[model samples]
Target: MKNELNRNYSEVTEFILLGFRTSPEVQIPLFLLFLLIYMVIVAGNISMLVVIKTDSRLHTPMYFFLRNLSYLDLCYSTVIAPKTLATFLSRGKQISYNGCATQFFFFALFIGTEGFLLAVMAYDRFSAIRSPFLYTVCMSQKACVRLVIGSYICGCINSMIQTGFTFSLRFCGENRLDHFFCDVPALIKISCVDTFVNEIILFILSALIIITTTAVILVSYAYILSTVLKIPSTCGRNKTFSTCSSHITVVSLFYGTVFFMYAQPGAISSPEKSKIIAVFYTLIIPMLNPLIYSLRNREVKNAVKRILFRKKSFH
Candidate 1:
């Protein structure tokens, strides 16, 4: 009974998200733009997933990682984009407190998962490029599956820890969140209780994740570059460089937005400023992912062509 009473009084049922600004001029344009972007992101990621799933040619370790990345994009967008779109349309942009926390929890989950998965992808590339003779042995079907699973598992655990800490914070006053989504920094700013410990924990965790993932990616690319340079055939070197370039571009975009948004202290990282940067990772990147990979990859293009031809024949 004591625990129930404390829970009932302690928990906040709702929160107001200040959402960019309250002007009609801004809201309409923002809404339309985000809606279009959301559609494109969903369409692009889904197309990639479908292409990978149906095509026999794409049943390789690389495409498997790409498929997982696409899936993560879908999950990541779903966590924030719909709510953001709704907030734009609504005059009163209020979300239930539980709802806000829930959103943040899932958002953190996928963001962390993507980071780890990207690192795994980097290692996969490293193995492929640096150890061609042992590449198949190193990245076997069982190993790839385990690596992907491990990334997600680690992400889930990390998110749970972060969310638990975030929820323990007290927010009795100023319920308005400065950002569009229920981000940790925005939420922490409005907490009525002490937030020093929470902020430190979050900061340390964020640093660990970004630092570890970036280090792995950088090291992998270094070895990859060395191996590519050692190729005796110019054509082979060119092909290897081309393949790694797309992955590197995607990884750079992902980590760049992440570092800009979360890797700094709140004193330095402005919520308003970060929100703009956040759009790249949240909306634009997902839409661009399929285009970057598909256009660059001959195998994906051929699969797409075959699929289109099959549709024409059926008609």
Candidate 2:
């Protein structure tokens, strides 16, 4: 009876995140593992940013976008990693109502902005490869700055709408959120009122952003593929393909998971499965991004070597 009174929308003040439902013995292991992963996520992204900023050779539009990508990855992981780490160690996984809103807003902002930025990178690749002579004029530094600013602005506006859309609903129901973080689908699932309209609007807005960004990538790559096929020499073809390979790889990783989570209907059918997938894209992907770029891209490797040699010379 007392619980029922406290759970009403007027009275509810916090949410308890039910993290992973694994066995008790695994909690410590998971905690340790996530803590290490979070550390790597921070270190890797910061290193990427530092390398890009210091290396004069990396001062191109491509690396400019890459720099922002690392920044977003860092911000995205930090938003959830601390809270997630807390859930594993402590019994109290309670988050205030405002805290959840802040988390959702920032998460949505970075994720949304990153998606748009990838499309811009794709456009960058397309221009460089398809029209080398015009590439400089097309992707001039000032133009690149505007493009990035526009992406963030779009993300911020959409984030506000999505955040307001989700949090405006009454939560006179269960306070135990199934997932480790506050996400659109998860919050929608727990609303006390009729969420049919809210779900549609949210899904539509999310889909609009995903689909629009994806279209830019697809169209850009299609042109790129055609242009690449026309190159006569084998070595030339290989070089052209290599230029955009890292961008395409990251694009595939990001879009694949995002599409599965948001685009598909009835995604919340298996909460455990959703959580596992969420762990991959949200936490694991950020850690892998720096490694992916540094390992696969020849220029990044060269830059790291140059920086190390310079530091050694200084010492």
Candidate 3:
């Protein structure tokens, strides 16, 4: 009841995001750097989406998930990158309460969707490698569509819960968020009321999302690895491993940073360290996804080559 009373007297209308407290000399340079990264993230993800859509040969269950992943990365980058860039360029980095809440919602939505999608992709690989003959029947068009839709639904549900709980807290004073964006942990840190319930909810949700996804990915890869080892020819084994390696690399990069950020005790979290880690997953990873997939996956490379050849011929 006291908590309810505290909530009734909410005070903060806006938050000033103290984004990366760097020297004045470096602010412009930092802004330019992030602006460049944002542009690359946009171009790379869009190109991958276009290439996958246009090339009939690329329209498999794998590429279907890849297309969704690209779209997620695109949206994810937009949620954080532009705001971070603006903070670097401008003197005042104030975000209205509504604006902050909206950012947190989409950020949670896309991040959760990506986590689920990565697990789904791992399962897709497992089916392809372990049950080659049954791969088509296993990952049918309807099944693929359902999996993608399910990911989005899960993301929406999780984000709604997270956003609701985080915003319910009464943030009365100290509206200065010591992070580049309005993340849940950052918001919870500033609330005047007891946030024990919010923290428990955050921990449980993070554990469920991170653990379940990581477990699925690990189990899928375990079976995948066993199946790959059983292949007779060394060349075939190498090719199979190559196909799985890109996904593994990306998963490692993403899950490592995210787990450290959310899964740890908030008392141990340093805003400076969190900001750097956030930059990696939120900005660098999205830009790197296309490069990693395209450079490593032979089919994507060939598709890009084909598209370029056709364009050159036309010109």
1-315 per-residue lDDT for model 3 (tens digits): 224455566599999999888899999998999999999999999999999999999999999999999999999889998888889877889999999999999999999999999999999998998779999999999999999999999999999999999999888767999999999777887788887888788888988999999999999999988888898999999999889999999999999988888887653247778888889999999999999999999999999999999999998
Candidate-wise lDDT, in order: 0.85, 0.88, 0.92
- Model 1 lDDT at residue 265: 84
State TM-scores per candidate: 0.94, 0.95, 0.96
How do the residues 1-315 of candidate 1 rate in per-residue lDDT, one tens digit apiece? 012233334446678777777578889899999999999888889999999999998898988999999999999988999999999988788999889879988988998999999999899889988788998899999999999999999899889998898888876646778888888888877776677887788878889999998899999999889888888999999898888888888998998888877777853248778788778888788888888888988888999999999999999
Task: Flag the better candidate by TM-score, 1 or 3.
Answer: 3
lDDT of 2 by residue, 1-315 (tens): 123453444645788899898888999999999999999999999999999999999999999999999999999889999999999987989999899999999999998899999999999998898889999999999999999999899899889998998899778757788999988777777777777777787768768988999999999999999999998999999988887888889999998888788777667556777788789888888999999999989999999999999999998
Separate clash counts for every candidate: 1, 0, 0
Q: Report the number of the highest-lDDT candidate.
A: 3
Using lDDT, rank the candidates from best to worst. 3, 2, 1
Pairs that collide, model 3: none
Query: Over all chains combined, what TM-score does candidate 2 have?
Result: 0.95
Model 3 collision count: 0
Residue 76 displacement in candidate 2 (angstroms): 0.8
Off by over 4 Å in 3: 1-10
TM-score of 3: 0.96
What lDDT score is found at residue 315 in candidate 3?
89
If both were scored by lDDT, which would come out higher, candidate 1 or candidate 3?
3
